[model samples]
Target: MRSVSRRSLLRGGALGVAAVTVAGCAEQEPRQAQRLAAEPPDPETMLIRQLIAGKERTVALYSSADSDRLTPFRQRHEAHLAELRRRLPRESGSASPASSAGAQADPSASPSGAATAGSQISVRDLRDMERKAAALRPRQLDGVSPALAQLIASIGACEAAHALALSRSL
Candidate 1:
């Protein structure tokens, strides 16, 4: 084995540190890119995007329902989604509500296990989801445009009405 000088040891140690630092930075770059790609640029637009996503998920839920009454309700969500998409800024790219909403519209997207396998969703579950969604609208109003705020309120009212209708159906 060759004798190792102190300078050589120091150089190897520095190179190892440099290599680790570079590797760490390289790993972080992709994660940063992914985060930027996944997150909406503005909070207001993010809120609208979330609402559109929720409506799409709701539509998916209603679509999977066995009842004829749910069909009109599902259609209403589709109309809401269309209107929401129309309100989204053109600068939003393909990140517009329509595309993003569809991407997240799976029934499994619901947090409450409301759309489980082999089991039909209960009317109570629908009511609960609508009620929760409607409750979220007031909180979403502060940072949005007046027209968007009005639309959110209207949609919340509609969801509240849906909750009542679902309650009656149960």
Candidate 2:
């Protein structure tokens, strides 16, 4: 067999290297795409997160009040919070209350931060919050799973009752 020429051997080696480089780049493109593309959270997950935040807020509101009469209501909200937490997906479960509720100040706090630690949120304010939350549940049910829908409906009913009871108690 004729001896291989140096120029031909070099050209062959360069072509092989080029082929490997292209193949390696092609394999990496899909991986890079996967790393960059994040899927959005599901609607039910979002609803559950919001419900957890709202329940936390309601619990905090209840805690701020000195009335012993509101203890049972607060306990119910705590239960709701537990259930909502149970339903949260594993990946998102680590999200903190502040992150979920955003960076805003507490709902009962005054803009000037003048509301002292002993200041109590009014019954009317709680009632209005309950009414608004109750009204929002129906809208929230549209895209959630059946189990979640049922839970939301039950919570909404309780909130409506709370509003009515607060009105009578006032």
Candidate 3:
């Protein structure tokens, strides 16, 4: 007859926990989010990729730390990436972003945060971005497709929320 001792059971439970921890770490693809795929020469595609990279980094940071406070903000960032990519021109869908007047002239843009300008944004920084997005609306809506206006408005609202969340988190 086999006897199950208390110490043996405790050791088995500990082993189970260790196995789960190792499995969790093994399943993580930490660098996949940083790998922006090479696409054709499309500014819109490049911009979308930039947005995705930024959002993914933020999400990863929050996820690794198990922070629930950032859930909504991370979701909004993901939405902006998905929505903007869906609305971009197909030809420019795979191209790299261009640093020219043509790309600059795009009134319809995404919220990429202060990271785009080579700095980290504070709570106030997010609020400023929201305000800027709202101001852009009047001019951006001028003679453009209704779709564009709606998209910008959606992003504006989300950006505002991000500002509020940042303030609370900080």
Candidate 4:
């Protein structure tokens, strides 16, 4: 029998294991964009849409805003909007259902859906929105795949961090 060096055998075994591990982790992502399209937006989904629209307006508002401190937070809100859209179906991603809901909630006033938790949303609104997102962090891990859950948690944390930074700037 031919003698194999112990170091050579170990190196070969390690390479084979590494290849198998990499291959195992390479599952194709499902076309969830299409899947979410066929379903009606749930209440949770509707809430997200509201937030997206609010962020969209925030980005637009802040871009023209005079406050130097708000510029980056506005940009972050824009990025956050894009990330939030990635989590939803392409079609409903553009919906502004919160405006309608807000209108319904108060007949005399316009649906200022962008209004944050505070009396009047200025830069402070970003902080409020981030606080709300942080509350959703734990739910990210519930019933979802670990990878997706982590993505959600990270995004939520990112929003929370943005809010913190914005608060300081204001």
Candidate 3 per-residue lDDT over residues 21-68, each given as its tens digit:
988876664444334334344533444444444434444433443446
TM-score of 2: 0.66
Q: For each candidate, give its TM-score against the true structure.
A: 0.67, 0.66, 0.43, 0.45
Over the full model, what C-alpha lDDT does candidate 4 score relative to the true structure? 0.57
Candidate 2 vs candidate 3: which has greater TM-score?
2
lDDT of 1 by residue, 1-170 (tens): 99999999999999999999999999999998898788755866666677677776777677667789788778888888888777766776644545674444422236365464246777777778887877777887897889999998998898889888888988
Model 1 Cα shift for residue 167 (angstroms): 0.6
Which ten contiguous residues of candidate 3 have the minimum total lDDT? 99-108
Q: lDDT, candidate 4, residue 170?
A: 74
Q: Model 1 has how many clashing residue pairs?
A: 0
Better of 3 and 4 by TM-score: 4
What is the model-wide C-alpha lDDT for candidate 2? 0.75
- In order, candidate lDDTs are 0.75, 0.75, 0.51, 0.57
Q: Estimate, for each residue in 7-125, the C-alpha lDDT of model 4 and write its tens digit.
A: 99999999999988876665322445456656767654554555555555556555544577667766766776677666655555354444323311211111234663333456655
Winner on lDDT between 1 and 4 is 1
